[model samples]
Target: MALATLGVVVPGIAAFYEFVVKGRKRLGYRVQMDTTATNVVETDDPGVFDQLREPLVDPTLVLLRIENNGQTHIDEDDYAVLHDKKAGVTITFPDRKVVGMVVTELSDDGMRSSFEDGGGLAVKGSRILLPKVPMNRGAHYKVLAALDTMNGKMDQYPPPKVACTIKGGVTGGKIQETRSRTGTPKRVIALIVFLVAIVVAQLVVFTQSNNGAPLDCASGHLNVTGSTAFAPIAREAAKSYQDLCPDATFGFDMRGSGEGLQFLDQAGRDGKADGQLTFSDGEKPDDMPGLLPRPIAFFLFTLVVNKDSGVADLTGDQIERIYQGKITNWRAVGGNDLAIRLISRNPGSGTRNAFQRRVLGGVREPGTNSDDCRNRDPGSPPGVVRCARDSTDAVLRTVESTPGAMGYSELGAATGRAGLTAIRIDGHPATVDEADHGAYPFWETEFGYTAGEPAANSLAASFLRYLTNQVGADIIRSYGDRPCAELANPQLCRPT
Candidate 1:
């Protein structure tokens, strides 16, 4: 009986060893790697992963293909967030000394990263990317990875290591790259006569406001768009730039800063320029490939409520809870007995993004980004957060009309507007004077972005260059935000 039992147990153990251990080995032995063909860029296209912190990094896509060439089937799983949740895989770049790779999957559209959603999974043989790594152009890299599974063991992110190299990219030729004569000799003769008459009628209206400055430009047009927070400054700066180069025209209208970055992305990525949007202003975006951000000024976002509400102040903790939907009543926060009506901006709005990030500390505000706004409502009976308005004036009016309504907006937008009262956060009054001097805690730098450095002769490039000058500084201050002329804080400092 003992011999019979020993024979059965011994065979089972050997079979298990052959199936598991040998299978992983064979899988690793037969792995392969494949990379897509691409080119290096001449112009510097900068991008940032952590908008509020990280330095600019160029966007370089790296895709790796892993296959099973072994005689055995090696079961595997590749999921960045899920893998981490279930005891993730071990990956490394010996050349860069980066270990523990967190692989992410594509979005439903398969056009974006699921890093935010934290959902990427793979089984058996598949292809994966080097989850948004900043790599130097015109260079080679060695990547290695490993993983664990239910049925069998795993090795490396794709099994065997691969060394890949990158080269420079090329662009198409510009349209009408040279000059051409448009008029005939007879037309030119008439043009010369017309020019003489124009010079005789030309009168210089020199006012003290001009300060002896004259319209001194040739001819060109540029559109400045996005970031209503910075619109005043940008619009005013257009006048200043025109003072130096009057032949050039600039367009800046009312639009959210977040939408401005999208304009830049569309222009940079698809090479399609908007008829009236040449530059975009706002907080820098996370992915900034083929672009650069210049921090020009600083501004604050203030919390405001209907003047009729009895609430005057709130602690940071209480304010956070209010947005979290934990404290649903105005009375709960020392206000009149009323249901707190939460008013919020769209996710695409730059002001909303700043308020959420700075005030909520990355926590989702209740009733925002959900079937409504977030996940839950912050009212007494639990209701969807209401849209205040896209325009600052409109938002202020909405809050004033709706009793118990509270919302956030740029300090400049709420100030001087009737029927709205700005609330103090943590005993600190939200004001431009306080925020500019760093007395207030809630403020963010205004950013302008472009596709690398603009061409030397391009008016858009010239305008950006002028934006850093003293004239630009003066114009930025005229807006609600303070232009950081001499500041040590990186957020306020000008980006090189």
Candidate 2:
């Protein structure tokens, strides 16, 4: 009877390890594609392949994908290698020599810097060494390697031998060599189906126990209205929340920040504020007693100029002078002799308010002079051509089209736009790291405002909780903003 119990208990433990414990810190790798099957070596004309400097007798291209296919994040310090060792894993191609390798794709652009020269990504002999890259859940990167079979026949292409010499810090962790999607084993498929069914059953039980309401879910409609600069993050977060809670819905009315606050104020006075929410670029006014504020993230803003401007950096004094109409032409600031056009946001814009408070020293700029922003208005002075735009997109478009035009916009909105360059301030780039270290000043604390506090179980309250959680923080960081909760100094998000 003891032996029989041991037999059953051992198998149960094995199944639990295989299905549950094994996936918590898994490092999965797979050969996405091998060019051996399609190699047609034309020996007569080697000149056709001039793209490679080194001549190859028998070339094979291998695309390898390495991922953190696990539930938790894998930090760089989690690698189980020596302290001085740079490589986390070494992949060997038997009977083949590695000619070159390049990182092809990344799940997140922030991982690109990890593949730089000193990050341990190198090709030595028949092996490719990889760095200890930290990966969040579902994050992956692809490396495309050019390999030669040492003049061996290409017909018998041996599979790669992946060894985790550089990647061993995980508990109960083993680096797995996975097959292609079509070659997945039947037993693995059955196990996955079984685990999914178990999870579904648990979820059903949990919902039933909670009186028919799902975890972290509220059934209602919410209207998210606020800073157009933060609209991208807001929309993404709302979409993710709706996906998690199918009964919930969201409507967006992203006007300027001040406008959004005023709209929420009126909604609160009318007792319709329960369904309305607004996000501001900074703190709300002291006059609005009923409204409550919660800091969500730190948004970075930058000054952008047309490509023809030839100016890259500006001092705070120079910017203030330009807005104050003391400087007129681009040549005055070491650029071409073109006339300077100022594209600015309107009075109700929160971004404009932040700029005035932080950069302009609480001083307001001269009123908008030109309606078209090209030439001065008929009765206005013939100095700087100043105009006001209602939204961040309008400011960027105007700065992109008009030569010598300059404007300020959210960093994410200004990035990668053609014909405009995001300039620096006092030689400091507009980056989260820079802002954290106090080198950058063009940023603001983004706040989510409600009309007093919504009920604990209300949709507005639940959505606010979700916005500060890990999922919403990821979405916020993806757009180049830094969530306040993740800040090195949490006090930075507080009202000054």
Candidate 3:
């Protein structure tokens, strides 16, 4: 009788353990932004919902999707071991500076909020594990790991950095794999193993801090330069393309478009133009000849003022007068009764050229940046627009700091800066929709030009091809430049 009872008990225990405790529970992860998806929040404010495509207003969060590819289920309590890491996302910039989310916005759908409220879609706490949620085999769960747009550190046409690690499993004595922790000794060992796992992950991260640092490739170095306007975009593209072709590396110089065209011309003269690539935020000059024009992205210049200016929209004609030193007071354009400070860029700025031609009726404005900004007559208060910054960064800072100050920038360069407001032109704001509908007029077409045409197998050609495709276009859009596809509306344009 005793022997029979032992046999029955042992078999029963083994069967129970096989089905309940040691079932396989492996997980795989993907970090993706659902570009096709948009989460719109409605409020009493009129027309806010209608203009969801205002570039910065879209609140699509980046999702860290966890898929249970195991044979067993994973309860929420078992999976809640997800915290203890930084915001669950890691963003490395072109300069290899790593920035983690300091604002712990770990939240989810139930904790929904808008971009205005910093209501991004991060999952809030391990609280979502309260009811012991189950992750069945082949099932998926998504948590908001990061917001689409983060302020401060990320400003002006930033690149996409999608490097992250998502680790999930049971904690404590519950061995997630097919290992048994049924005894006091085993449980103690399991706990030790857990601590070691945590240490190893941290060690791997710190041990190789310089593992993927951007390379200064001199061997197969691909030098690209031009347009400070497009320099930010080029920097990002260089990083991404390096990831694609590890053998091909890049150097980007943010000299103005004039320099870009000049460099290409020199390269052409030396018969080494095959080794160069250049980009610009404006059209190719007639003298900068022999360059194939491959439009990479669409960029726009927007009139902007300090947020305190109380001025919001400006017609083309009014903007023309302001830049031409005609209109000199805020009250002249329905704002405070302060002097209308005319801000201009240094001489030969491509932005200035475009503005002068399109809005200022091609007439170059008088006064050097210093000369115009000079103290005016006490009686007149303000007059000709003066004050110029050689760089866009300086321009943005100048505009934001000055009261009643107005200036212009490539839409991307101006978007994320604080204390600055991009005024609408003719009641239409710069947006993808406005660009598509042709309502927001006169956007500069960005071009990537090689000395001649790049060969099919050439590195420059490959990079240019990448830029003109759907994926490349998406990356460009991520940088705040309108992809050529929007203009290609019924037609998708690819590099020849």
- The candidate maximizing lDDT is 2
Residues 386-443, model 2: lDDT tens digits: 9999999999998898988999999998989979888889999998889888998889
* Candidate 1 per-residue C-alpha lDDT over 245-292 given as tens digits, one digit per residue, 9 for 90 to 100: 667887666577667777777787886553334333345666766667
Which regions of candidate 3 fall more than 4 Å away from where they truly are?
1-219, 369-382, 488-496
Which candidate number maximizes TM-score?
Answer: 2
2 against 3, candidate with superior TM-score: 2
Each prediction's TM-score versus the true structure: 0.50, 0.62, 0.54
What does the lDDT come to for candidate 3?
A: 0.58
Each model's lDDT comes to 0.51, 0.80, 0.58
Pairs with backbone N, CA or C atoms under 3 Å apart (clashes), candidate 2: 80-169, 88-166, 88-167
Tens digit per residue, CA lDDT, model 3, 1-496: 9999999999999865654554445544454332211223555663322232222232222334445555566644454334322132233223222111122222233222222221122223211111122456666544332123333323332333433222232321232112222323445434433443343344335435545432232226788977777777778776777774578788777667777878888888889886688886666778767777787777777888987778999898888777777788778899888677667766656776766765676788776435335345445534554677776777788888887788877888898888988988889998766755768764667778888877776778777767766235556776666667556452322332
User: Candidate 1: global Cα-lDDT?
Assistant: 0.51
